[model samples]
Target: MISSVLVANRGEIARRVFRTARRMGIATVAVYSEADADAPHVAEADQAVLIGPAAARESYLVADKIIAAARATGAEAIHPGYGFLSENAAFAEAVIAAGLVWIGPPPAAILAMGLKDAAKALMIEAGVPVTPGYLGEDQSLARLQAEADAIGYPVLIKAVAGGGGKGMRKVDAAAGFAEALASCQREAAASFGDDKVLIEKYVTRPRHIEVQIFGDAHGEVVHLFERDCSLQRRHQKVIEEAPAPGMSAEARAAVTSAAVKAAKAVNYRGAGTVEFIADASEGLRPDRIWFMEMNTRLQVEHPVTEAVTGVDLVEWQFRVASGEPLPLRQDEITLNGHALEARLYAENPAGGFLPSIGVLEHFRMPAGIRVDSAVEEGDEVSPHYDPMIAKLIAHAPTREGASDRLAQACAEVEVWPVKTNAGFLARCLDHADFIAGDVDTGFIGARLDALAATPEPSDEALMVAAAAALGDQDGPATPWRDLTGFRLNAAPETTLRLYLDGRPVLASLPQGDVEADVLITGDEVIVFEAGEAYAFSARAPIADLDEAAGDGQIRSPMPGKVVAVSVSVGDTVTRGQVLMTLEAMKMEHGLTAPFDGEVEALLVSAGDQVSEGVSLARLKAAA
Candidate 1:
C-alpha cells in the first residue's frame, strides 16, 4: 500500500490530486518550476521541491529531476498527472525502476498506444473500428504528400506522439497541404520531440466522443461511459459533457464496448481514455463512429464522468496502483445523472481567442458551483503555461438543467485585468442551437460571430457605475461627490462619462435615485443586473495627445518569448507576411506586416521575451 505520493506535474491537476490524497490520509509531495515556487499546489503539499526553471523541459519534463525529488521526499509513489510525462513510457519505466509505485497504466501499455499510427493498427487488429488514415513507415515529405492526396481533400495533419490538440491542423485543400504539414511537424517536434506525422480523413460535421476506461492487473477492464467534446475551437475542446447529448443507447453501447475491447487488447491498467470521432451530419449512429486515438492518462474532463457515475477515478487509480482489485465489476457500474463542464480560460474571445496572460486582479467563481482552480484573486497567470483559469461543472437530473445551471454560473463570474472567456462561455451555454443539442465540432466556429458579440450592460448597471464614481451610494463620500451640478438656487441634471470596454457611455442617476445592486471595489465595479454580473473598468484619464498606429509598425500582441524573427532589416514583405512568431500560453501568434513594405528596423530577436505592446519591428511603406 502506498502511504505517500508525489504528483509529477503542476497547476490545477496537482491541486486536484492533492485534495484526494489529503482526504485519503496520504502524505502528498509537490514539484514545481521556478515560475511556480509560490503556486497554490506547492503550498498545499506536505512537502514541496523546486526541480528546475520555468520552461517545462527544464523542470517537469526532466525525468531524473522528478524521480530525484520523489526519492528525496521519501515518496512511496509517483502520480504523473495529465500532460508532461504522464504518457511517457520511459518516464513510467524509470519511476518503477526507482522502486516507487507508478499510479497509472503499465509502461508497455503507454508505448502500445503512444503513437497514433501504431495505436490505430493495434486497434484495427483488435476488431475495433478505426478511421481510414495513412500511417506508413516512410515519413518522407513526398510520401506524406502522396498519401494525403490519396486520402482526399479536407484532411488532418496530426502529430503521432502528442495529444491535447497540439501539433494538429486541418487542411481544406491540396494547395495548402505542404504548409500545413510543415507547420504541424515543427510544432510536433517542439512539443513531443517526434516530428513523425499521420494523415487522416477529417470527418465531416464531426463530434469528438471518448469513453473513460479503467483496468487492473487482474485483467478486468470496465468503462465509465462517454463524454461529448464536440464544442471546440481550433481542435481544442472548449466545453465537454458526460453521457453525450442526443446519444442513443445503441451508439453509447457501441462506443463503450469498443473502448473496453481496445483496453483489453493492450492489457491496459489504471485510468485511460479511448477517443473517437463520429460523423454527426445526421446525428450519432453506431456505424458512423471510428477510432481516433487513446489517451493513456487521466483526462482534463474526468470530473464530468465522476459526477454522472459517482465514481472517484483518482481514488481508483490509487487502489489499482496498490494491486487492488477492480472497484466494481463491469455489470455493476451504472450512469446516474447528466453533468456538463465549461473551461474558463484567460483569453480574449473577441480578439480571435488569443490566450491572455497577467495578474487575475478580481478572480472569483460564482457561489455554490463546483470550481476546480489553482489560482486565487491575486495570482499571476504566467505565459509559461496553459491559460485555463478553472473548470466549472454542473450536475442535474437532465441535460438541459445542467447546461442552464452552468450557463448561469458562468454569467455570475467576475474577473478583471486578465480578461476571461466567462461571458463568451455564458453565451455558448444558452445559445438556442446548443440548447436543442444541435452541436457538432463546427458549431462554435460557425456561430463564433454571434457568440463573441459583446454583451451590452443594462441601464441600471450603467447607473451603478455612475453612482459609484460620484460616491452617492452607501460609502464614504469623496470631496468630488458634492460637486455634482452644484448651483445656487438652481436645479440642474448632471451626467457622468465612462468607458465600457473602451467605448464612451453616458450615465445619469435614475428617476428614483436608488443605487443598483452593485459592489464597488475601488476602481473596479461589479454591477449585478437581471441575475447576471457585469464588470467594468474605471475610465482612464483622457490623454491630451495620442499617437496613431502607423501601417508600417508591428507590435507584440501579447507578452511571450520571441520564438522566431523571420524578417531582417531591408527585407521586402507583403501585406500578410509573417515578420516574427511570438509564442505565449503554449500557442504561437504571428506578427505580420500590415501592408506591402520594407523592413526598416528589426527591434527584437529570437529568444527574447517581450511584453504586450512592445515594438518588435518597424516597416517602411513601399514607395
Candidate 2:
C-alpha cells in the first residue's frame, strides 16, 4: 500500500482526497500557493509545502516545483486531483522519472486520449461509436467552412485540445462562420495553447451521459454505471446524477459496454470517464448516442456514482496505484438508489451568472445531506480561480425523491452576503421538466427567466435583520440602536430603516430589549430565519450609488485584467457595441457602450488589470 500521498491541487478536491487518505491511515501531503496558505486543505494535511505565488502559471501549473515538493516530503505518490496537472502527459512522465508513484493512468493512456481529434480516431478503430465530424488536418479557413457546409448548418466549432467548453462555439450559418472561427481559434489559443480546431454536427437536443470506468495494472476494466450531466449552463455542468434518468436497460448495457471497450483499448488504469452525447430529440437509443470525449482522471461529479454504487473512487485510485487489482467485477457493481449532485457557485444567476468575489462573512452547511466544500467564514474568493464554492449531494430510493431532497437541501443553505446559485439550483431540481426527466442540454437555457427570477425578501427576514441591528444578539444593547442611530440612552423607534436587497425596507421592531438569532458584523447584520440566514444593513439609505454615473461610459463591473480593447479614441460606436472585455475568475465579461457615441478616451490598454467601477473608456453621448 502507498504510505503517503501528496495532492497536487487545491480547494475541495484536495480536501476530499485527504479525507480518504486519512481514513486509510496514510500520511497526506498538501502543496499550496501563497493565496492558499490558509486554505482548509493545507491545514488538513499531515505535511504541507509552499510551491510558489498565487498565479497558477507560477505555482500549481509548474511541474518542477511540484516534483521538488514531493521529493522534499519523501512522498511515495502524488495525486493530481482533477484539474491542474492531472491530464498533462509530460507531468506524469516527469513524476515517474523522479521515482515517485504517479497515482494516475500511464502517460501512454493520457497521450492516446488527450487530444480529441486523435482520440476520436482511436475510438473509431476500437469499434466505439464517435460523432460524425471533420478531424482532418486542414488548417485553411476555406476548408473548415467547406466541412461545416458539408456537415450541414448549425455545426460546432471546437478546439481539438479543449475540454470544459472553453474553446467551443455553435455556428448556425455560413455568414457567422468567419467570425466564429476567429473567436474560437483565439479562445482555443488562450485556453489550450493550440489554435487547431475541428467542426462537428451540434446536436440541438443533447443529453450528456458518461460512464465511470476504472482499470488496474492487470488490464481489467469495469464500468461503474453512468451519470446524466445534461443540466448545464454556459456549457458547464450544473447538476449531475447517477444511473441516468429513464435509461433503458438495453441502452445502458450498450453504452457501458462501449465505454469499457474504449478504456481497454487505451490500456487505461485508475479512474476515467468516457463522455457520450445522447440525442434526446426523440429518446435515448443505442444508435443515437456517440462518444464525445474521455476524461483521463477523476471527475467532479464522481460522488453521485459513489452514492449509488457504495464505492469510494478515490480509495479505488489509491488501491490501484498501489499495485492493487480491480475491486469488483463488472457484474459486482450494482446501482442501489438514485443520487443527485448540485454544484453551488458564488455567482449571481439573476445577474446573468456573473461570478462574484468576496470574503465569506458567514458560511453554514445544511443538515441531512452531504456537502463537500473548502471555504469558511472570513475566507476570500479571489478572481483567480473557479467560482464554485461547494457541491450538495442528495440520495434517495427513487429519482423523484432524490430531486426533492436535493431541492430542500439547497433551500437550507445559509450563506450570507455572498450571492450564490442556491435558489437557482433549488428551482432546477424542483422544476417539473427536470423532475419528469424531460431535460436536454438546452433545458436550463430555455427556462432561464423563471429559474433566475429573484424572489422578494420575506417579512420574516426583515424583522430578523432589524433584531440584529437593535443589538438583539447581545440583549438589545444598553439602550437601543435603531434606524435613528439612537444609543441605548435614547428610546429607539418602533420602525427601523434597513437596506435589504438593495432597497430600503422599514422593519417593525419589538419595543425595549429583544433577542434573536443574529449577529452584527462590520456594516452588515446576518439574521437567521427558519434556518436560512439573510444579510442586512440598517441605516439611512446611502444616496443611490449608480446616480453618479454619466451616460456613454463603459465601466468594468469587477476587478479584472483587461484582455482586449476593441475601440480606440475618436472611434464611432453604436449602442450595445463592445468596447472592451475583462477577464475575471476565468471568464470574459464585455463592457459595452450605453448608447450610440464616439469614443472620447481610452483609459486602459490590453493586459492592464483594472479595479471595479473603473471606467475603461468614455464615449461622447449621442445628440
Q: Candidate 2's C-alpha lDDT?
A: 0.86
lDDT of 2 by residue, 1-623 (tens): 99999999999999999999999999999999998899888989999999999888789999999999999999999999987889999999999999999999999999999888999999999999998999999979999999999999899998888877777889999999987897778777866678899998999899999999999999899999999999988788999999899899999999999999999999999999999999998789989999999999999999999999999999999999999998898889899999999998988888778887788866777789889997887788877788888999999999989999999888877676677888899889888899999988989999999998766567656655675576554444432122322223233556788886567878876445444445566667766543234667765556655544565566777788887788888899998888887878766677788878899999899999899888788888766
lDDT of 2 at 258: 96
Lowest lDDT sum, 10 consecutive residues, model 1, at: 482-491
Query: For candidate 1, lDDT tens digit of each residue in 1-623?
Result: 68999999988999999999998989999999999998899999999999999999999999999999999999999999999999999999999999999999999999999999999999989999988989998988899989989999889999999798888999998888887887788778878999999999998789999999999989899999999999998788899999999899999999999999999999999999999999999889999999999999999999999999999999999999999998899888898889999998988887777887877656668777689997987788888888888999999999999999999999878665677888889999999999999999999999999887666787767866676665544565333122322222221345878776556788774545553445555554566542234555456645434124465667788888887787789999999888888878878777788889899999988889998888889998888
